[model samples]
Target: MTEHTSIRIRVTGHVQGVGFRAWTQARAEELGLWGWVRNVADGSVEAWVSGPAGAVADLVEALGHGPAAARVAAVETGPADAASDAAGAGFRILR
Candidate 1:
């Protein structure tokens, strides 16, 4: 079986108010990853994604070049604790 991995990422730049969360959700879902994306107070986007390591990595790469409206400056990624529940089964945009 393919090993799954989780990652927490913080994307900075023109990420908020530019459909970053929704765009991220769509991208994650397309990759069959489960996790959530939200706007941070500091004008950044944060997300926790878990799935096949390759898929998660792909998502991270996409975050760097978000929707055309977004001007992603940086994407920081780190390991995240895996959840037992079906946390990665669906992607969501959190407020």
Candidate 2:
């Protein structure tokens, strides 16, 4: 069977109001991953992603840089439970 992985990411810094959510969606789609990205009340961008382990890793790395308008400070990653598999079939920009 193919390898699968799931994780939660919290990106801090200049992520809000910078098209970060849309950029994340595009990147996840390009990587053929499924997940949801949203802005937290604390001005951080949080995401839960699930896909091939390598793809997820790539997404995480890309997240560190984010969009050109985003000055990413830190990317915090950790394991996420199956309940986080909420995007159903595609990547999404959550409100």
Top TM-score hit: 2
Per-residue lDDT of 13-51 in model 2, one digit per residue for the tens?
999999999999999999999989999999999999999
How well is each residue in 6-93 modelled by candidate 1, as lDDT tens digits? Answer: 8889999998988889899999999999988899999999898889989998999999999999999999998775663366468888
Against the hidden reference, what TM-scores do the models get? 0.92, 0.94
How high is the CA lDDT of each candidate model? 0.88, 0.94
Stretches of candidate 2 off by over 4 Å are: 86-88
When summed lDDT is taken over every stretch of 10 residues in candidate 2, the lowest stretch is: 79-88
Which lDDT value does model 2 have at 43? 95
How close to the true structure is residue 46 of candidate 1, measured as C-alpha lDDT?
A: 89
